[model samples]
Target: MRKIIMLLCLLLFLTAAYSYPQSIQAYTAPLTADEQHVLEQSLSIHEIDREIARIESQQNETERSISELSEQLEGKNEQIKDIREQAGARLRAYYMGEREDLLAALLSVGSLRDFISVLDYYELIMDRDRTVLNNYKTEYADLKKTKTKLESVSAELTQIKTNLQLQRNRVAALQEQVDTTLGHSTDPEKLMAMIEELTKYWENIGLYEVRRYFRALSTAMSDFSDFLDDHKDSLVSEKGGYRLEVREEDINAFLRDKNERLQDVSFEFGQDKIIVHGSREGLRLEVEGHYTVENEPENSITFHVDRLFINGFELPDTTRKELEEDFDLGFYPKKIVPFVEATEVDIAQGTLTVKLKLSF
Candidate 1:
């Protein structure tokens, strides 16, 4: 039953994701061009500084809010305590005499009106007591909400700072190596070795690459959507479901560009997603889906999307980790970097192509 309920919730969530205006695409390439290389280095530094400053400011604000909320809650408790203390003192004085004596004192009032006034005052005290308790309750509820929000924001900022810090360290180390290598006279062997080392470092630092790749893929998805809008009637059937047909040649180009082995591969539009089922080398990834949704294309369009599932099974563990980190880091995953960006996109004979390696 738990599994069923969870599955229902997941379905609802995916339906919403599908309904949003977004697109998903994947590509990979080695960095080329001296300008691009320089920019990547500069971008890495800028990203690190921006992220650090952002994380620090956000965490400080969240911490301050939590502290303020704590003090306010404590103040409410003090107010309740004072009310209780006053009530206790009143009870102590009235109850000092025996029950009969206390009744006689009340009966010895100056007049019926005076007795009635005393009763009304006692009722007023009781009302004040109830109001104080309710105030405490209300303050507690507000505090809980504030604290929860603070924790979430703080955790997110901390994680982002940590991730950015890691990237910053990596870039700094690489920058040092680059500077040292450049300082020396031109040596092809040393340059080659440096390149190899950098490549290995990039692969090991999986999160950074994953972040950039997804950003590029997202931009491509948007361009693909614009292409679709121009040819929407061609893809959408009268039955309401969409069909995007890609020829084998198109798949071949994708494989050549991405360096994916194409044996045991298939492509088609599956339900509300683009399905890419193939074995890359011997990894045997199957049942991958891609889709594009039209958000406002008037100015700059924004897309919110997910890869959904991979292979015939589910997405690999790394994908989930990246997403969780993104949440914890308080980074807007795609908006800051689209998965794909293109100056000009052209489709020929059912093959989709775009200019690659754009700077954000």
Candidate 2:
């Protein structure tokens, strides 16, 4: 009977424990977002305080240095003032018209140093007073710059102080809530979630480095395009009348050496179509040509009709590297490989015309 009572009591206790409600706690804290933001602001405030303190200490050292420099500058100024009033005054008087007395005074200085000093005083008096004035101007500019910098630093420090106070107040408010509720959270999950949010924000915004690079590239391209547009006509006209300019030397060289100056000219367009006209007819090698910019920023321009119907046809051989170089269409990519549907070149009545239509 005793064993049965003990077993029944243990079973009842187990059943009651099993019936107890389970408490499901959150893995992360439920702190309001505003509190988290306040925490982040507090951290920034701490960093700002450290930076401001460092800067202020540096500023104090700079101020002390400036003070010492000012004192030294003041003494130098007084010395300069005395030199002007005494030695400089006498020198000016001498320059006015007292030549003989000035000469006598310079001679009366017995030692070499004294004589040199008298001469220096005469030279620096009123004639080169600009030197002293410039020195004063430079010092004033330097002091003004230093003061401006200090004012900026002081303003920054004030802002840092204000931010720090605001952060402290926020932290105090959070502490009050904690105390009133008698609750504390040291949840790692909550901290990690907040950190992840901040990280995402930073990543999305990116940085200034790539933006600066693209900005520079855009500026350079704009300047380049402007330059090209400005000089487009000059580049087009550079080859105009180039043939005549180098023709004279070729004729002269041909007269001197026969085989050394032999050259040939051929014109074709589109298909592998060939057109031939004998020199026996009235066809002149000298031709006038007009070119139209079929494809802007050209490609290959082809002259379709190779044969010309002229008053006469004259075949003269001329060997001139300069002429070849001048007319080399390979020099311009647009003229060579036109981004167009087709290019046509025709020669008629000693006149050559090139028409181009570019698609690309």
Candidate 3:
């Protein structure tokens, strides 16, 4: 059977990331000016910051989209007008059963050096209205749809900006409240108690679940190392080292069986790095990173997180480094099989290869 006991433990723990619980009786108070009589402590600064960043990114993207769509929509109308004008002025008499007038007008329109030159479908049809208007109808519909999309995205951008402003005001209010509370209180003990309550809010918001998620990832890595050790005796050896290649499909199957924790995330193998992206708890999460050989010539290789994002909020370098070091998803093969050390790790296309060598 697959080793999922510890992995499941991680999964079960991480699912509670949004709501941090404690044995202490929870604070009871009104949440905000809008939410009256709700029994809860104030929202954490970290949560508000994340929300603002996510909304701001969305607003920027929407503005760019609206600009591009407006330009396209503007040019589309002119294109349709030109194509129709060229078709009517040059080819209208052809379907009118007047060959002489058709030939004269077609020849007179500067050798039909207009939309006819652009479209170049003159020889393909006698029904100019049907052929040229075919393109017109499609272009017109696309132009209309572009208008609709532009309007929608513009509205969305407005709402995103509004939300961002509201979040900013909340942060300001929070700061003002904290400052006022600290200014009035002369007792050091009461101030420390108030600071501790805020700390609790920060710890409970989402940090606990994030750590649990990392542990689950670590457990999966350890299990893979154990698998390689158990099968080392029967594995093929080349160039004095053993190589194991696990494909993306293989990893997905293994993870699904090993731990159901990261159900929302999917992993892709790049030339040298692993790409992870998915929607988690209504936020888009993206991670790009790779593993490198142990720096101290040890038995393990460590995962170095290059980039991480939630919605569009990037994790700070300091916090990212802390997470990477604290929950390093490393494989220590020597601990499992004596003298065997992981020498190299690389990701290519759909596969992740680990090369192990016996050093002693």
TM-scores for all candidates: the values are: 0.37, 0.27, 0.42
Clashes of 1: 14
Give a tens-digit lDDT track for model 2, residues 256-321. 232221223222221233232112111123322232323445443322222222112111111112
- State the lDDT of candidate 1 residue by residue for 23-110, as single tens digits: 1111112324442343244334433455556556766776777677677666766665666566565556556854346456667899
lDDT: which candidate is best?
Answer: 3
| TM-score computed on alpha carbons, candidate 2 | 0.27
Global local distance difference test of model 1: 0.44
- Compared with the true structure, model 3 gives a TM-score of 0.42
Say which prediction, candidate 2 or candidate 3, comes out ahead on lDDT: 3
**Tens digit of lDDT per residue, candidate 3, span 126-169?**
46557676776787788889888988888888888887888788
**Candidate 2 lDDT (Cα, 0 to 1):** 0.39
Q: Give candidate 1 misplaced runs (Cα > 4 Å).
A: 1-39, 70-77, 83-126, 184-360
User: What RMSD, rounded to one decimal, does every model reach?
Assistant: 19.0, 30.8, 18.8
Report the Cα lDDT for candidate 3: 0.63
Residue 77, candidate 2: C-alpha displacement in angstroms: 2.7
